[model samples]
Target: MAERPVTDRGEVGGASAAHASRGDAARRLWARPAIAVAAIYIAARLVTTVFVAVGAAISNSRTGGAETIGSLLMRWDGQWYWVVGVEGYPSELPLDAAGNVTQNAWAFLPVYPAITRAVSFLFAGQYPIAAIAVAVVAGYGASLALYHLLRERIDRSAALWAVAFFAAGPLAALFQMGYAESLFLLWLHLALLVLVRRRFGWLYLLIPLMGYTRPGILAFALLLALYGICRWFRRRVDPLPAVQIVHIVLLGLLAAAVGFSWPLIAGVVTGDPSAYMETELSWRRGWTGDHGGFVPFEGFIQASAIWFRVWGMPEAWGYVALGILVVALIALLVFEPHVRRLGVEIRLWSAIYLIYLLLVFFPQSSIFRLLMPLSPLYGALALPRSRAWRIGVLAVGLLGQWWWIDQMLVQGTTFWQIP
Candidate 1:
């Protein structure tokens, strides 16, 4: 007898138990509830294009830009991609221009244009609506991802409902826009889901692409990378019970990196990173808080009305809308305390996401559509437990979402033009 195997039952049992858990996890899909099949069940959420039209009406009614009459959705950054992809950027500036946007061509260089170009080529420009169409696809694709990711811990039924919430939020309107918010969210969530699984090598490669995708994603990518590395090292001693401290420190640095990246990069290229900062601060377009410091808590409070309310007043409502959205998010998170594995799973991931959204509020529009990716976490927290209530609330939220987008996408008198 080969030296009577000396395997300790505790260690052997631990390995055996781990395998058993994975096997159980695999079966979760078959045993999953009906709600988890959210993507298939709630195909009505695909009316995103219809809602996009609604948002255009609301946005246009408030804005009076040149494109407002024909198709109001084609304002600000929207015009950039259309004109650039449809008609490339101008290489030369008019005589008195001194390098200001003498023409409407320059906004296309970011990731949005590249996606648009590919789409237009594939469609043969038979429809200049390439960007918006891509957005529609991205929105649904992200929704599908959310369902699969959440179905693991929550009942399948609730997971499906969460998909409903995501598809039906103002986030859908943001997704419909010619902007890159939808694409960015899709990328961020997929990357994060990967992170949750402890796959670091892939996480590093994805961060830079994310960085290039939107302005601050690079910082987000970097911060996540740092955390994953530290966690890996700490794994030698077992998951750090005190690791939360290190996380907080990393988060602070992440905020700093994101805040400074725009100006810092510009400064290096233009021999003055503050060039970007000057554009934002010299003008009164963004947050009124101290330009050099972080966005204060009070600033967020002031912007509370942006998410749900009309926030008709520009300065006051801007801050007020964001504040309200923040509150709503926190409330939802708290209500679903059971979802964090019923308190077993700490709320750190969602918290980090919430904080990231708050920090970026100073620059983005007051509503903070950036929190869209964080919704799956909230949805995960609320599922299968309530079942009926969960689906009902999500239905209302999703319907209201379309209405919101519809209302936003209107004619000149309805939308606001930033000074």
Candidate 2:
């Protein structure tokens, strides 16, 4: 018999393939570099949480609103999630036909305190403690997920830094309480990891559920479209066709349809979505007299402007800075070194999806957590050379994001109330 080359049946190729698939997970778990990144942040969060708890215990007092960063974590969105997890929804005061309510779960309950309640059910003693614990743990897992995903594409060290930023970054405050971002980030990491596998069919199925969770999913779905186009472009001659555009369209439609139904239900009952909006907007606007509720685009702009002023800006100047950052991001992506490597068709699709977010949707609801997906979107196109640079940039970003959210939740009063 002639000598023959070993095939996959010889075990090497099979094992290599298996190794490629599971390599990042194993390495990320055991690797010293990754553990070091995760550990520093883990210890930092542990110390901060203990400090906050001890401070609360020693003072025998608590401050609500934006006075202290810790208190901001304890209240606002934290209070809302705690309420839902502990009490569930009460039918006695169902949301109005416009989908507005005393506790408007429709506006933001897709990512509620379900995890907190489930964890609490385990011990049933200190729910507040349990809720906080869930937030901290979920935040940690989210860091691991982010690290693992980046590690799959980049180096192990790069992934470690990415995970470290996720864990102990200024945005750490979000996890210190029962906020949606705490849970939302964990789910997002899993979703994005699945996306990297080029599993559009699975993405289409899962994105709708995510869409139901937060308004931010609208932006996320759009980013997915951009990534899809990028993938399709990179392999045109030897094209990879497993992923398709139909999933993006279907996911968009599903998100739009499901989210729209909530408002439509109110329109059916109250004559317009603005009816529920009138109340919510009025409260948020701090109106002593009759003022209208959020009218979608108009309301978003108006309320966000007022909020910018509250953040110590003169008149929505933060929006201008935000615009500049976005512009820089677009310039970087459209002109990445791989632009030619990615076919024109793929590039075009990516542009369409990303531009749609900038032009139509994001400004309409440019909340921080709503824009969290942008971090990944930016990360996708950003080919960072220096690990130190990546760490430094993300450190600044995390701080700025924390300040923005802190101002929104802790400092500012309510704006446009739903009717």
Candidate 3:
């Protein structure tokens, strides 16, 4: 080769040094947790936006190009949220011809819609714009919270991987939709982090936010109750102080109060003692006929039988399957090494939340969205050191994201296709 121009060092050495400098800079940039989390969240949101665009295009094509992306994003529960924001919940609950309570804005909580309505002033009073903005922004915060929460238990690399999975997993489209899930998740992750760090004081604020953002605060209260019991049992080892015990008790009570406060408010507004419960049960009526009253765990059992019969299986098989599932989950939390790696607080929250869901939620297409709270378990999936395993999980999650968007957003033309 002709003589390469080099001042002091050889050409190869200079080029190598330049490459090394660039590599070091890249490492330094990635070392910052916020930057890495933002990068992951931004990239994932872009992918989800593409998926949403594809769904919107497909939906419009099917509907003679009449639907816009905003309308598509504002479908299903989004419409309900908008109604809650603009019109407000009715003083009188809507009733059907049969004199049963019907679905109304009371079924949806106030926080997300209230926030969206306020933000809409910035977007020319367009609730859709404001809703998506809130969801997207809260989703980014949730991602950061989740990364830090995982970091409390796992290594930095694994925590980042967990966030990657969470941001790109199935139902990721909710982050860009008009739903309250993203905001609720933000509060939930922060609440869990504070709980893990023994910062019970933060929960006084978080509990109300979570209670109004979604219906899962009761489960969190239950978690706190169990957490206190566990602390008491392990006090010899962990030394649960008197102050900490008082926090646990007061927070548990505060969370429970807030959790039940919405129902009480709905009852007061509508002049129907069972207004909120009846409104929620109105949704389950579509599948199970008419339920006379709200009963814990009854919805799941009835839904299991109904779904199993629809699927051409014996109804008893559904009960058996439910039993098996409960056992399997208990085993996973108690025995699985990967899950144990996520630490006790996460595992306890998962168990409590699952129990709460089983108690009140009817099994439906929306169950997937409801299960988003258990996302901390994703850390377990990211724990294995095998590169192939991590990549496989990530690939599967993206594929699921596309499938969920298509099924629930694009081709969701029927009642059961609710997201």
Candidate 4:
């Protein structure tokens, strides 16, 4: 046999060695704590899907509807979002016999729908599946953001626990569904991460779109304002750099505009500046009256009143529980050392959003779902030194998610459980 050329053999051996080294490096990267956390998160979601699907199957058995795994993931508000994705928002809000803007597509924000529509175009106009896919993808991004954000403040193991806890939270089922929560969370966590990392300049881009994604732009803007003021004070900027101040002011204005974009469009189309408010309040018009003013503890009062009447409990008990719950929330925000231990970003987000929730939200069975955005905060509670404690928290979260799916999604139609 002809002797192989020495140069050719050497080159071939060197190439094989380099390929093996690269493969080894890749394996090392895959074994990193962050990657492991992501794997756990994904595994938890797969388990959550199974639980929700089984619950839906049982629900179909009892209720006798053609509910499938896919349909089960796209119930209630999912359907509304799909409508906006397939058929753009109605130019004229649907009006009731009394001329009040009845509940319509306007109640659902447009960003998620707009995204779904864009994706649907790629999929030959199959929107429902597209909508679910968007939610699922956004949710995973949100989880990674949360993990990365937590890692900035806590040890890797604890941060992993926090992400896992979030994935197993009571409303985790919604993360994989066709709803806006996942997308909203992706932006919200990302914004917090940027804030924690002291990248204020990026807010010019993030805040505006964040505003468009949900109705809580003012809360985030206020947080930014507070941060900017603190930064100025820390630096003792006696005259305040004109450029820095102007940038902060512009960020606020941009946030306001983007956050209120849909409402502004609605107002212009309907020739009613308050059209968005009117549409939002239409759902509560029956009992909430004309004005959409914030009332402290009003949601709890509304919920307590409902429970008192429906469950035949003493009205006093509802008030007592409400008081306890409110106090607990306040303590968590104001006094809990664990809260202070959180990154300033998460701490501020929790305190501000909880205030917004208590003031504006009318509590009901659906209140749990509404509070889903705050799931990131609970990750702190999941940070226990004891392995058993960590496992216990995760178990409770998993069970809560299953129960939510069972009661709210499956048995909800006949019962009073809200989706």
lDDT tens string, model 4, 244-342? Answer: 777767776776667667778888877877778777767655555554543466645665687688888888887887679878887877677766678
What lDDT does model 3 reach?
Answer: 0.92
TM-score-better candidate, 2 vs 4: 4
Worst 10 residues of 2 by lDDT: 410-419
Clashing pairs in 3: none
Against the hidden true structure, what lDDT does model 1 obtain? 0.53
Q: Show model 3 residue runs off by greater than 4 Å.
A: 1-19
lDDT score for residue 16 of model 4: 95
Sort by TM-score, best first: what order? 3, 4, 2, 1
Compute each candidate's TM-score over C-alphas.
Answer: 0.63, 0.66, 0.96, 0.85
Worst 10 residues of 3 by lDDT: 1-10
Encode model 2's per-residue lDDT on 8-99: one tens digit a residue.
35578778779887997776666665466558557758755554454444334435312443554556556766776777543333544554
lDDT over C-alpha atoms for residue 354 of model 2: 56
**Which wins on lDDT, candidate 1 or candidate 2?**
2
- Tens digit of per-residue lDDT, candidate 3, span 1-419: 34445543586788999999999999999999889999999999999888888888887777776666677778899999999999998999888898898888998999999999999999999999999999999999999999999999899989999999999999888998999999999999999999999998999999999999889999999999999999999999999999999999999999999989999999998889899999999999988786689889889888888889889988777788879989999999989999998889999999999999988999889999999999999999999989999999999999999999899888887889999
lDDT of 2 at 170: 47
Identify the runs in model 2 with alpha carbons over 4 angstroms from their true place.
1-29, 32-41, 50-72, 90-103, 224-235, 238-249, 261-283, 287-290, 293-296, 303-326, 336-370, 377-419
